[model samples]
Target chain A: MKPKIAIVSASGCRACETTMLDIHYGVSALNRWAEIQFWPFVLGSSMADLERIDHLDVCFFSGAIATGSDRAMAEMLRKKCDRLVAVGACAAYGGMPGLKNLKKPATAEAADRGDLPEELALPEQENRVRALDGVDGIDRVDAVVPGCPAPVNLVWAAVSALVCGGEADARITYAAARLPEEMVRPILSGLGPPPGAVFAGEKAVCATCSRKKEEKRFKAVKRPYQAYESTGRCLLEQGLICQGIATREGCGGLCTGVGVPCRGCYGKPPATFDPGAKMVSAISSTFETEKPAEIQKIADDFVDMTGCFYRYTLPAQCMLMKG
Target chain B: MTDYEPKIIAFLCNWCSYVAADAAGVSRFQQAANVRVIRVFCSGMVDPSYVLKAFSSGADAVLVAGCHPGDCHYISGNMKALRRSFLLANLLKEMGVDEGRFRLEWIAASESPRYAEVINEMSESVRQLGPMH
Candidate 1:
């Protein structure tokens, strides 16, 4: 029997769902082997229709859990879906929305201060935003496809896994047949990792990056706008503070493969709890300075350390609140 | 005279600060009784994660003590620790933690008195601020 699929988005920008669709060539192959039971983002489907469904073979759930309603939605999907895969950084680990936890949490009451209609009131937001798997009841995700929008290649891998049938480790006898030689890339032509894999890969992105590396020695770290012409060398070597050193490897080093520095859209490597801490250690070690006074000056370079480091994973930070 | 005592988590380097702390213990120095020390090989080995872990784990204050500048046994290990402390300090402050709660200091092997003083000072300041959570 064809696997039943559902692409659900909670409180996210809807980028992950669209990025999944960006696998244009795989659409035909996806349609052939899996039936999309629900995709409320582009398709016309109400919450009532979703409630009507008894079971889903695979549910690609995306978004941070920022409110009571989002939590409820996740619980509802968990009961119906056999495999609940977090499809983006937001769902896999607290993404950009989790940054709100760094400050005093905002309230939904702020929306009603403008004197709108009584029926237009917003749902109460939870005190802290969290990854789907981070929540208490929805504590287990079968697997996670990590990326901001979850680079389309990883999405292709997940879809093809379901279509191929069997477990996550199952071998695909034949990948998409319609795609030509040039169209099929290495990232798109793979099966998902075994279940319980928290990330896409074991190594950090720096291990896979193709950039030319040298003895890293920089006196100053530069922000993105302060960057000059690319040397085609390592971004960290150029003092640009690329997060590749701490970020989990996958997506084929997509951003760094080109010219752009990694923003750590994928969360910390599997071994790490905080990418910011790893980044701090990386920066401190690579920087070329023996003088203790110069070290203090280098530390002063970061204008917003929290935003620079914990821009994504603030909710799961060791300190949940400043008490 | 008071029952409340702040819990201070201190990471002391093996070569310098740890030795001073041990010496202070043997010398019968009147140090604050609130500190719990974790001896590391070098202060540089203390990751920023450890600092956050201390703060989140009910510590009223966290301290990273190492060899004085240029006095590291590993030669530059202390330098790396100093640099990480500055950055980690800013990170903690920005997260709304009191700056006084996290500190980095140079305590040479011979400066047992300084180790005693540093711990007591931090413990008093933390007591004024109350418990972390």
Candidate 2:
């Protein structure tokens, strides 16, 4: 009596192969508690086979948002699945396709290359791509997995938990930082913050990093090369631009710990709130310089590195490129 | 420190890095033994975290070698790698980690000798930066 789970993948994402491979190996390690079914790639034996599939206990949607006939197919899966989960950055956060949220010409050189198939061809304009959350009338999704092709472990763990009925205790649950009741409550009421609401030192990390000789802090603002000293002080305090202050702290600060800046992969509303936007606003006022474009480019390139993870998903939230 | 030799993991793209590394070996270029090469389909597959993973897993340094920006075998894989490297370096600096632990360079298949030279250069730089913990 194994629990049944189905995965629905689209054409452009091309993650069906990788996800299938991961699931095959991942389930081998699991206690064989669930029966797996994949659509399109695996069970597309015939049109009758598609109709034969009824509402599934669990369903995963992977790939970028598609339109025309593809949209109808996606909607059908959404209706037939009991528990719907968005896997992979494209499905979960709109990946490269979501970049249309911001009005910008595509800058990714890969977008023009012929490696990816023609099915992924975006609309000629920036208004085309949208996150699943942005699709009108869609309510909350059960869960989301982020990453270019959402890491194999993420899919395995989430599905395993659902099958075991301990989904609430899943380690990858969404845990956004709690904004002040004063700021959030009013915003919920449709009232924006006061004109001079300066966001400074709401948390200890921000306070400690911005400390100006008021407390015992590390001297000398270190750059990428010099910050490697074995001191545990925040790099931002030492005059280096660290995005960890605004970035979510799940990745074990891998970027900061390894002599790089936080690219904001785990930050904000992957659909609306851009991690790059928050980072620049936080530092722009502090690190004032004449050459603003140079600093902006450095920040832009950082977010672009995550590719579809950050850029394509929350194009509007991007600090430099907007999209 | 007895002439600290940096242990570097070089992720060579199949077309460029692999060919260049092999050429270096064939040309008998005198390079540091510290660098170990791993072949990947393209530089785009080299996630930024992979660089951090290498360093944390006892690698003194990690180098992501690819074809020049426009020369990726899979079209824009190198460009993606470049974009990723740009972010990775900044992320490392933000984390209070030493920046020299990661290096991103481009080398052509015809530049096997240059690949060896780059490896030796990175080893020297990491040696000066001290061991990453």
Candidate 3:
């Protein structure tokens, strides 16, 4: 049976338009034997039509939650939908506007710099923008396709997988692809040392790509406490802020290759440890540099770059957020 | 007001900027030798970081010389260089570096000597601005 897929998004029409366009194009390419309905933007229809629709196998939630109405609608969708997929970074990690959540508590001095654009300007609002994970019951989100606007290829693959009853395979594969093969092999083997356990020495995480493989299973590896080494060695080893520790192995290690550091979109996977937290801890452990000023500068620089994708995973509770 | 030298790094594309610089040299234009020219296969081959690196490495000014925008030998290498320069210039200003330190100029092989004149003029302008931190 062709699973009926319905996509529900927030009030913003511009992003919703782009999302629908990508999904429409993706679906057309897959030529899947499935029927899909979109709420707004490209569908040229109303949400009232959604009630008439039934038996949806996959439900997609796209766009950011900006207004009270959006929150209400999203909650309603969560209850009504079977399998909810978060589309776009906004839905997954809270997009550019989500960065507004990290604003420091108001100080009279800092508040004086409030000459930002209308949407960003303040007398800042009291409640920070909520990530999708902040919403209750939305936690069981099955899949996430990220990009300020989710990439068409990823969205297509996710949807196609759902259509083929390959959601489990896709979920594991998603994390597997993001992770290095060495890590994946042990993970599949159900062995010890666990994910994010900090293997000693610079072990390439994947063999197919670059991870170093061990002949025998290694256990109880001690965390290597190396300081920041600038020779472009693996980020984990240098204690120089590498996302390889926390980010899923897939990406074929993309960002690190291109020179932009990993922003941690993979976030903390459900298993061993949060990758972001581990990397942060590693960086903090090497703070024996003795120069407070230099350490502060490095901290600030690391935050700006690494924090790009931090809000998605760093929970509202981490001290790193206070920093 | 005074004769000054421009410490400029000219990233010339093999097809055009290289030719233009050669033309400038062959013409015996008698321009300042302050400019250090680096030949690249394509202007697009130049990364924006290279421009930033040049500034940090103490070049008073960075000039990217390429074929006219649409005339790149690799089909838009010059365009890519142009876009990159536009972005790098804005970024440099944001980083508190003097905005005028980065420049992008299009030159053809036949206009090689014109390259030397440009170097002398650009160097003089930057010398007036003093060292960029």
Candidate 4:
């Protein structure tokens, strides 16, 4: 019997869902192994259909809880699904839009206003964007696949584990004759990463990079434009603020592999506090800035520390300053 | 504002600021009652998360105090603290955390009066700001 799978989005840009369309094995292959019950696109399913679904085996819920509608849909999906896989950075850690938390949320006075008609009222967005698990009704997410759009191989691994067991993978491999060994992870057998675990490797991105590393003696931070010496050495050693030191490993070090610094879209690394605070602590230890003027200079170079460090996680990390 | 008390979490280094706080207590100097101190081995050891967590928990304001430059028991620990303070300050500002809510000061072990003064000053400033939102 095929497992019933549903793929849904809360308030995402649809990139993660769009990326799902190219999972290498393709949608046709997915249909052969499991029943995709309620994907959000090209299907004739409506909210009524979603509400009517009895018990889905897995629901790949992408994006963050931004509005009242998004929150309700998240709760509904969680209740309807046996396992909720938080796919992409927004669902896992509250992605780019989470940065809005830095600004003051809407005023209580505005919420009290009753000028608009019932139909004219806005969708009622929440003060701060939240990840799936952070929603009040949802206590936890079974598995977390973190990335900008969520890397394909990791998603495939997670999908394979949840939908079918080893027997199916072997049969599919035999049938297709193109199952790569590295792609089918032995550990991600069923449900992939134990409950509430991240889908990617446990190591930080620095461990995966092929660049030469030396003892860090950071004198100053250089903006990406100011990075002069591009000799394939460690980006951090060159005075550029590469976040690979604190970002989770996966994506095959794609950003750093081509001289671009990691933006840490993969969310917080395992066994750590918030990555932004950790980065700050690490910077303090390595930085040799002495005088007040020098320290301030380094601070100025950061320009936007919140965006740089907490770009993808401010919603989870933001202290509630509003009602 | 006069009736309200601001909860200030002060991370005082065990070697310098904590010792100074003790001396201030023994000297019977008038000090603000609002500051609650957590003695750390070194100010540098106060991870940025600790301060951020303190703010989110209940602290209206947080103060991290260590030995003055060249006076740390652990050599360059104070220097690291100084560097971290700037980084933390910048981050707090970016997060829209009230400017006066986070502070860093250096008090030598001999400066008991300075310890009491710093505490009282921080308490008064926070009182004016009212309770943390």
Candidate 5:
């Protein structure tokens, strides 16, 4: 029997839809075992069609819960589906829009000041904008596929595993499909599965990066906008704030591979609490300063510490924002 | 409210600051009885998460006391701690935590009076700021 699958987009940029479509040739293989019952982005399913559905085998819920309607839709889907998989980072860790948690919630008065259109003039429903995990009844999801837009191969592996009557192990599937044999040989050499092997690999991005790490100390940290020589050394060693040391591995060190620093979009290692806190600890330990005033001077070079540290996971992790 | 006692979590380095705190107690230095000290091997060993945890877990203020520069048991451990303090301070500011709520100071093993003085000053400042939210 074909498993009935439903795909829902909540409040994200529709990246998850792209991820699903990126499966490309693999979709033909998937179609043999499963039927996509409801996907508004692809199938143009209306709300009436969703309400008419009595049962669903699996539901891929993408995007963060950003409105009262989104919460209601999530609850409805949870009740109608046997299994619900949170797809993409927005659904799992709140993604980029989660940064808004740092600011005060929008008010009716602000909306009325000609800043927003008439349709958006009203205040958001109370407690509407939230991370998917923060929602009351749907906190415990069956599986989480975390990424800005989850890698296509990983998505294929996850959906395929589910269709094949097996649990989707993101770690095993991702490693098998993405990692080269040479890389896997050293990693599998007498080593247990890493600590946080859920959505991404256990080690930091630096583990996969090819940069040389000679000395960790730096007199001054450089912003990415400043010109510097990339002499096959670690970006952090060259005074750039490369977050590879604190970020979870996966994405195959895409940003760092192109000489750009990682912004820690993959969330934190499973062992850590807050990625921002881990980053603060990691970066601070490398500053070569003994004097109090000199430390402050070096720290001052990095403007907007919170924005840099909690760029992606602020809404989901920051203690102060957890009201 | 006038008699409200503030709770301060003090991370004291075992080599210098912890000894200084002990000396203050043994010498009967006049100090506020509000601080709860947690001894660490060195200031560098104190992760920023510990400080954030202290604040979130009902600490009215957090004091990180280390050895004077160039005097760490592990060479430059205190310096590393100093750098961490700077990063933590900015992070706290970004989080909208009051500036007076977190402090870092260096006190030698013999500076019992300085320890008492710093504690007293921190206590007064935090008392004025009231309890952490």
Candidate 6:
């Protein structure tokens, strides 16, 4: 019998759906052993149809828990599916919507009331956003495939592995797929140490980043808007608040590889409890001043400290209040 | 309200602030009884997690006391601590933690009175702010 799979999209922008499509020919390969029982985006399956499904071999859930309905669906999937995979950064760690938590609650409320006109009043349901893990009883999620959109190949590898009765090693295989070639090549060639790191490499993003790290000393922090020549040196060393040192290295330095500073989309590295706080610690240690006033002045250069630090994982951060 | 005592966690560097705290006790200098001191080798060794954990674990405020700038036993450890404290203060504010809740002070081993003064001030300020959520 073919394995039955369900694809659930919650409060995301369908980026995960796009990632599914990006698999291209891999879909056909997956179709050989798995039957997509319900995929609302493509299969036109309704909630009633989802409820009718008695069992699902695997359920790939995408997006953050942003409403009462989203939480209900997540719970439903957990009950109905044997194996549930959180298939994106939103589902895993709250993603971009988490950034809204950085704003003061009063400020967010005022913006909601003041910005929208009477006819365009936002729905009450929109205010109930929460991270996937924030919802009670969500800890039972079996595995997580974390990324902004979740690299299509990694998802494909994970899904195929699950459908082939290799459920035990699916997560490990997905993590290996996310590892950088440079890190994996050593192990493959038997030259470097064994691979024991989860999802990303054991070290921070800087360990896999190609940038040259010279001794860094910065008098002032530079915003991305302020122009600076990219001399192929480390962006953090050049005064741009690149969070590579605090970020997990899964995206293979996709942003930093192109001169754009990493905003830590992949969340905190292993052993890090809070990504925002860790970034603050790393950036602070680089400031050139020991004088309190001068240090404050340099810190003032950061326009939005919380936004820069918790852009991707605010909902799951230690200091932020749970929704 | 007068009976409400704030619980403060003080992370003191062994070389400077911790020694100063001990000296203050030896001199019979009275400080706030609310503070619980944890000694580390350097102020830079205090990770932001430690401060956040203190707050989460019911600490009304956290004080990181270190060597004066240019006086770090490790040459630049206190300097690094100063920078971290600056960022942590702003982060705490952004998280809606009141300004007086997290503090960083430069206290040399010789300035035992300064340690007593800082603790007293922190205790007073946190008492005014009440307990953290």
Q: Pick the candidate with the highest TM-score.
A: 4
For residues B46-104, write the lDDT of model 5, one tens digit per residue: 88988877877788989999998878899988877788888888899888889988888
Residues A142-259 of candidate 2: C-alpha lDDT, one tens digit per residue = 6555545555554554554455444333333212223334533433344432222211112322322322222322223346676564465556655565655664333444456554
Fnat of each prediction, in sequence: 0.66, 0.03, 0.00, 0.66, 0.69, 0.71
**Candidate-wise lDDT, in order:** 0.76, 0.55, 0.54, 0.79, 0.76, 0.77
Worst 10 residues of 2 chain A by lDDT: A193-202
In model 2, what lDDT does residue B120 have? 85
lDDT accuracy of residue A43 in candidate 6: 87
DockQ of all models, two decimals each: 0.66, 0.03, 0.01, 0.59, 0.70, 0.72
User: Which pairs, if any, clash in model 5?
Assistant: none
Task: Give the runs in model 3 whose Cα sits over 4 Å from its true position.
Answer: A11-25, A51-55, A104-126, A137-139, A146-154, A166-242, A272-276, A287-311, A314-323, B1-133
TM agreement with the true structure for every prediction = 0.88, 0.45, 0.47, 0.91, 0.88, 0.87
Per-residue lDDT of candidate 2, residues B22-98 (tens digit): 98889899987888888999887876546655755678888888898678899877765665554456655553457
Docking quality (DockQ) of candidate 3? 0.01
Expressed as tens digits, the lDDT of each residue in A1-323 for candidate 1 is 88888888877887987876776465565676688888887567777888999999888889989888889888988989888988888887778888777665434444446654455446757777888887878757987778888877667656665445443332332132212222233323543345655435567888778898987776797876776646778887877878898888775677887867888877788788677777887787756776667877887787777776666666654343422
Candidate 2 ranges beyond 4 A from true positions = A11-20, A23-25, A29-31, A41-48, A100-127, A167-242, A269-277, A288-312, A315-323, B1-133
Models ranked on TM-score: 4, 1, 5, 6, 3, 2
Q: What is the lDDT for A128 in model 5? A: 32
Highest-scoring model, lDDT = 4
Worst 10 residues of 5 chain A by lDDT: A190-199
lDDT of 3 by residue, A26-145 (tens): 546434646766455556657577655654666667765645555665666666666677775566655454555555334333457764456443434324444465565465666565
Q: State the lDDT at A187 in candidate 3.
A: 35
lDDT per residue for candidate 3 within B44-63, as digits (tens), equals 78766466557656677888
Write one digit per residue (lDDT tens) for candidate 6, span A165-210.
5443444555656565554444344433222222344567787788
